[model samples]
Target: MNDHIAPPTAAPAPALQPVRAAGIATMTALALAGLGWAARGVWQIRLAMAGEPASGPPDQGGGVHRPLTSLEDSYHLVTTVSGFAAAVCAIAFLVWTGRVRDNARELSGTRPRYSGLWVYFGWVVPVVNLWFPRGIIADAYRASAPGERLPRSLNVWWGLWLIGMLSGVGLMYGDNTDEIIARAYAHVWQLLASDAAVVGAAVAGIFVVRAVTAVQERHLDEP
Candidate 1:
């Protein structure tokens, strides 16, 4: 009878199934949202290049362009929801990584050297933030692996995103605006390419990392 009172097992750490599923859903949604936003921006760029304003009061000439109010409303809704979901996913990933770190520490009999706060810094800082997050993620994955080799796909994706960010920044802020709206339209086209590449790479990385993490969690449950 006394043995029946053995301490209650901490509810088996919440299953990774739900977390992984939510992450996949979020990544897919976020990728689609980013692609949609890019398409909208591209359309606006085309219109602007045709001598229409990127955004301003509707002209009196009965231009074929859609009404400003309708456009604004659509833009607001898409951006708001997409941004919210992405933010939630980012926080969730941080939490998941922290859990992995803690589990590793317990198994190895060593202290965890990192935490969720470190993940936040990777996005919040200006220059270092871009590369820092990738490094941290890669490191985490490596730690979770039985050996230190990281998959080449992860490095390729991270590199492309970093390049995209650099190129986008250069195209947007790197020159005098003396050429008027036409130049602005050109800039918009350039920026669209850069942003699409960056966001696409991020989505791919998330999917791969999520799978890797899930496997790591399962392996840890054994022995």
Candidate 2:
């Protein structure tokens, strides 16, 4: 007769529902604010370029010389704030993603691992930053997906974002345009395209946050 005793089972990990909810809330708020700010900035820039006079101090000689106006100033401020908020949200999501990935790995009794910010930062650096971030974002989506099947709409939205980014960067930094023609029409289209992309990204971002929360809950509730 064997007298060996079985080892006690380990307690399940605590639920992270509250953290998940908070992350979702923060991400949504920041993303919305950021996107809104960017949209406003684009509109203001377009308007200013279309011969709208500045709202600040008049030119030295009292003639309204259409300098960058108060609207542009406010737009810049908004963009700055939005960028900061977005960065904060990104960091929070990164932390949440890392925790989720780690937990999942641990549950599978495998070594824990998490993706890095380089995936997202690939867009902000320089030349490589232009397109690398897109691939990185795709990779991230795949890694985060439950069954390796990313939503088709995400691809569409990202395609728009990439186009907008390329166009915006070109408008802002390119030098091969016909200055007169570009001044009349190109700038407006560029701003509109970029803002449209921002809107698309914001919508997709909402879905992503919701998905993250759902995954978090599922993982937390798993026995």
C-alpha RMSD for every candidate: 7.5, 6.3
Query: Counting only residues 3 or more apart in sequence or on different chains, how many pairs clash (N, Cα, C under 3 Å) in candidate 2?
Result: 0
Best by TM-score: 1
Q: How do all models score by TM-score?
A: 0.62, 0.61
For lDDT, the strongest prediction is 1
lDDT of 1: 0.55
lDDT of 1 at 6: 80
Model 2: colliding residue pairs: none
Per-prediction tally of clashes: 0, 0
